[model samples]
Target: MNFSEVIKQSNQVCKVSPDGKYLATCVQYRLVVRDFNTLQIVHLYTCLDQVMHMEWSSDSLFILCAMYKRGLVQVWSLEQPDWHCKIDEGSIGLVSSRWSPDGRHILNTTEFHLRVTVWSLCTKSVSYIKYPKACQKGMDFTADGHYMALAERRECKDYISVFVCDDWHLLRHFESETQDLAGLEWSPNGCVLAVWDSCLEYKMLLYSLDGRLLSSYSAYEWSLGIKSVAWTPSSQFLAIGSYDEKVRILNHITWKKLTVFEHPAIISNSKAVLFKEMEKRAVVGSEDLSVHQLTVGNSLFSTQSKYEITQLPAKVSVVKPDPDHANPKIGISAMAFSADNRYLATKDDNMPQSVWVWDMQRLGLLAVLEQTAPIRCFVWDPRRPRLALCTGNSKVYLWSPAGCVSVNVPVEGSFQVQSLFWHCSGGSLILLSKEQLCLCYMDTEEKDQSTSSDCNFTI
Candidate 1:
């Protein structure tokens, strides 16, 4: 319950520095840098117009930003804050911004256009490639950095365009017939790409990096659209979450549906799949307010196993599992979790809200935290079980088994925080709001100083 440092910005988009020393963000028409140790804003460089998106170069040397109103992209050196370069796209606005894995160049999209322009900072040159009439919403680079997976959003149908990164050449395109594309991600080894649709049931199409439709899987019994999809670190299994509040484990290579575990309620989104070390199994969360742990042998999907599916009810919201902890119930949401995983922190969409932690492990109830306004979002710090709750009242609360406690922090007024993410690497806790990203970290005096870290798994 002790977050003593603050990094504030005007814009909503912010990216942590690769090495975790500093944070680069966009503010009121400017780029700002803040020191993690001192919790002080050190440098600020104003720009001509509002920056749309920002990305840190792979080498951590430069931060490339796309200025929307200016219709230009610029790269700034972190070492020499004054040194910056700008490239023009000869358009009205900027759409997307990304850096190659090598950090040698960048890719930018023009407003409402199907063309993506590649900019080389070193050579000061730009290359353009056009695609079908669809705006690319999300994009990812391959592990080798040779190919790109672009998520193009059309009217009712969605498509993915595979292009060669080196020469900006179009390789192949895949179109969906049943559902709209919900999410796109490649496997950790860059071998397979998991594509989900937006129907009531979870449907996925796995394709190779070379644009080959390897295999497809569908759940006709479950009527939930694929909310979220996660691939294990080892790339051996793929976890799919559906509206039926069930998570199915599949074999990545064979595309076989192994087992499906049902949650208590309708899962509004796809559940994130992660490897839990304590149980040495897979942890899956659902919108019905439950998390399940299932053990699958290396060849279990190919054959059969005795480990029947077991699910424990969890808090339902736009919640994310605690990446640092492997415990089944230790998670972060816009709510809370009890000591024995029986009580969960939760709130509704109305005002005069009450925070309740329902105990699912013991199949019972725990405690309730009283609040004035509606509690919008929350998370229980895995390192600290006391729940951190943010409400529509514009306040953040830290509650424990003892009683109600408050953490010393500023009330973010720029925009309401929509989500909370505690970096497993241990630098700072990120608050994703509507307008700006508020980064909360520990002050230098508090004692435990853990470095923030991130895993590089695809999908």
Candidate 2:
């Protein structure tokens, strides 16, 4: 694996263009755009306030930066370097900013103002809407880019307002039963809108496009409510990850639980036994095995409590800790489904060997990687059948069904790999460690060589 050092310095935030041609990074108040392959600087712009957030247009032609302290947002285009547009709110600073799906409009939320402003790049016009002050991220656009859902507070009541994309007009507003709405997300097919409350509430409400409540789910009293929720690409299943250390899958058709997955508890009767003959050839020592037994009971949950969901007999899968002494007991912290939805990758909170890849269809363990450093995050390529794993240290491992390849990214100062981005073509990967951003060109020919290796095995 060969990676070109793009920026050796630390950056506050970094993003790669969707098309994978340009790499953008924000350091202090400077935003630099560079060529992905050559690592050559292309465009550079300095902001008045430190750029807190940055995003690229869908077409990858324009770069947008949000300045919270100055209450301003600057939109810069690669095509027009000298000409740039700014969205400034005088007294109330901008709290958050996002790009429309079409990349023709920019959305800005005002700090403590209970207002949201939409700016159109084509018409040079602005539209304002009332929003809830308590709802920090209570807005989302559908995947198809036709409608937008916003949760707002109206006269002490919480309501979800739907808007049309063309005119940005209110289509309908439906009041929600819960006053504290935490987050909003639209299904991949743009059929349903899911809204959930903070940890205080155990509610997950689903609504249709017309703002009608379709279905609702709640966590059990023993569980700590939901930590995150994700919809399958087909929109047939919804996976809810809860603080209770369980993953529950919901059947969208019936709006009920279909299956439950949880971390396996240690079996009291199971013992670590090694034959006298095999002990001589063993790679691990008995002392290590004894330590593993001592830490086996350190799981986050004790007794598994079943929650009611239409009384359907749920298919359950339990992920057990690795039996090997080299691996440690750790809770799952990050997970991602492959773009094809055929594979699921999960990583533990603090153990390197806790990364497991599973066949989503069969719900069976595919591979348990032997890692060195603890993993920070892992992502599957959107355009290819490959996975990239980022570790707590500045190391990244790329894996396919056949074999794995690893790379150690160099850092000038104390830093860790914060994020990874695979190019749309799957030919390159961008790694953002602290303020430094690096790009590696993936050698496709290695796939064949890796598959032929004796150590390589298929999932």
Candidate 3:
């Protein structure tokens, strides 16, 4: 695949619309929206200050840009290009902002978490929720966009707040077991909510939408507590990654431990684990470790007793050297499922030069990719099976079953590639380095067919 460089400079990270038709990025003090296929500017808005952050509405009809110097936010709609809405926090300043799942409301937090403001586009009004103290973790909106959950500190205690999105009314507020809450997340199906204590405590609490605590879990005292939590797409199982180098899957129905996946590198910490639910199977990827494919029979209607978990054999193995100063610690740094759910990518923390791609259907290694420099991160196209990987030397490698292509991004000073975002159609990619943002378009059909088969690998 050949990639043509589009935008060479940008202020902040770029975001793609949900449908992959448009790309939004901040060019200094202006927000520029461009056509994903043509790389032509379609809409541009100049803000009062440099744009610090940008988020697209779920429906891809609106773009929200946050100003850096001033604590202000600007919302732009595609239908009305001349008219725009502004959100400002007078003295406190805006700390962060989020768009509701339904793309109807905008949520903003004041500087120091002094308060939270909910802005509705349809009503053209705003509501406020005062905070007694600053919260480390912010609020979360359910997948269905009907409810919002957040943790607040009140009078030396931490309480979880659930709000109804329709009227922005406080649905319920309940005190958790520990006042030191760390995170809050609602299941994808919007049936349950999970809250966990900070690393100081190993308690994980599950609650219903009505604020009733359904179950609580604790890690062994010797463990370092839960590092991260992820719910299966079906909301039937919750995977918790602990510092003890083990991932525990819990059945929501039974509220009991279903199974545990032990990683090979005990010293390598797990930042996150991912689960991809396919037709009749599920793929689990553990950080710095391995990937397991399980045959989840009757996952939709059955309980934990009826599920089957199987660990796939090692398709690709890394050579581990003795732990010494010369050989840095090794672990799985990153992993992602392809858009089609047929390929899986895994990267090692120490060996950034290599990446492993697995075929989920056949449960085997598909390809092993090696690069000139250590890989910083990689993202799969949301609409295609193509993969884009960024390395430490400011280069990106695009891979597919057809072939592989590498692009070297020009750099002026000392900056590294930070992240990458793909347009919904998988034709455009936005690369954010430390200093600038760039846009690149991929032509999958125009690549040299003679060389396409040269990089092909089969297992």
| Top candidate by lDDT | 2
Give the runs in model 2 whose Cα sits over 4 Å from its true position: 6-12, 133-136, 265-333, 347-353, 369-373, 403-405, 410-415, 446-459
lDDT by residue for model 1 (265-351), tens: 222222211111111223333331111122355321111111111122323333333548643221111233332333344442221
Residue 279 of model 2 has an lDDT of 9
* Candidate 2: residue 43 Cα off by (Å): 2.0
Deviating ranges (above 4 Å) for candidate 3: 132-136, 265-375, 383-388, 397-416, 426-428, 435-459
Candidate 3, residue 393: how far the Cα is off, in Å: 2.6
Worst 10 residues of 1 by lDDT: 301-310
Q: Can you rank all candidates by lDDT, best first?
A: 2, 3, 1
The lDDT, on a scale of 0 to 1, for candidate 1 is 0.56
Tens digit per residue, CA lDDT, model 2, 1-459: 565644754344878888878888887888889887776889999888788899999899899998888889999999989989988887977888989888889988888857989899999999999865455468888888899888888777788889998889999888887747777889899989888876567788898888888998885764346666777777877777665666677778888987766643221112111000000112333333211111124332111111111111212223445648642343445667778877666654433344556666766555555444445668788866688877555556666666454444533334356778778787777777775766766666543543311223221
CA displacement after TM-score superposition, residue 258 of candidate 2 (Å): 1.6
What TM-score would every model get versus the actual structure? 0.62, 0.78, 0.72
TM for candidate 2 is 0.78
What RMSD does model 1 have?
Answer: 15.1
Model 3 agreement with the true structure over 1-459: per-residue lDDT tens digits: 334454544654588788878877777788888887777999988888888889999999999888745988889999889888888877888878889887888888887788888889898888889863454454888887898887888888888888888787889988877748888889878988888887667888999999888999885775447666766556766767665545566787888887655444222222221111112223333331111123356332211111111123312233554656652445444556675657667665544456656565554455555554456778888777788877654455677776565544533333356778776666667777765666665664544343242343210
